[model samples]
Target: MPTFTAAAHGGPVKTVLVGRAHNELVYHGDVLNTTARIQAQCNALGSQLLISEVLYQQLEPQPAGQFARRGQLVLRDKA
Candidate 1:
């Protein structure tokens, strides 16, 4: 069985070119870091997909019982 993990967050991010060649596009910011932390929880949670609260709130409302709450997750560097 193949397992997959995903996380989402809606916010501003800083993108810039990095590396010695200055040809690589890198994305950084609190939002990205938070998303990474959320993605890291997938294995432990045994879930195929994980969506952050920020993204969830931005999304259109869904039918009742369409999504289940996974409870709060304490992420690194997050107050």
Candidate 2:
């Protein structure tokens, strides 16, 4: 198994998710969850990176149209 490292750039987020090809498993964990959320946000906003409010705090006056505020979202059960 290959381990992946990820970092968020915009908002205040504690965790992130990511997905990878050539992997048997689909939902790895919060990492994967984050990846999905990022993808969804990108589709909605048409950007590359999706950051949380916390991250945005660190980077003020960030590039516009790159991030969208995703208010508290309830994630589904993780197995």
Candidate 3:
């Protein structure tokens, strides 16, 4: 998994896969919350992996160069 920086958290965090387990190290509250937020951000930005749009607009040369046109995406949100 990639360690994407969250502007809200102000550091790097890695997302882990989720599974049915009741161990602290195997599955903890903080770990689960962070991963959820990262997934939401990635989905909102329409990328497989992503940072916030705020961060993207501030790049020197603009990291947008690294992304290719994957075509327009349509997302469904719960009401």
Candidate 4:
């Protein structure tokens, strides 16, 4: 098995949805549970570490459509 290094742990999953509050990956007293599903999926996959899209956004945060997806990274060497 290959170990994937995730860089998205403990990041914000904020949204513009009405009647909701800003939320981060780790649950807190005030943060919404927007990232619960994704967190659960990662846990189920045995991925203790995660990459945070919000961290990337720290460079250039977008107004809308800020999203990130994960997949099994395949290594292929062509000789």
| Local accuracy of candidate 1 as per-residue lDDT tens digits, 1-79 | 8756798877899999999999999888889889989999888888878888888998899999877889999998789
- Two-way TM-score contest, 1 vs 3, winner: 1
Per-model TM-score versus the true fold: 0.81, 0.33, 0.30, 0.28
Please, what are the lDDT tens digits per residue for candidate 2 over residues 1-79?
8633333633223433445654453333455455555545554455555565545677758677665676754434422
How are the candidates ranked when ordered by TM-score, highest leading?
Answer: 1, 2, 3, 4
Q: How accurate locally is residue 18 in candidate 1, as Cα lDDT from 0 to 100?
A: 91
Give me the candidate number with maximum lDDT. 1
Quote model 2's TM-score.
Answer: 0.33
lDDT values for all models: 0.87, 0.51, 0.45, 0.43
* Better candidate by TM-score, 2 or 4: 2
Off by over 4 Å in 2: 1-32, 60-79
State in Å the error of residue 18, model 3: 16
Per-residue error (Å), model 4, residue 8: 6.3
* Model 4 per-residue lDDT at 23: 44
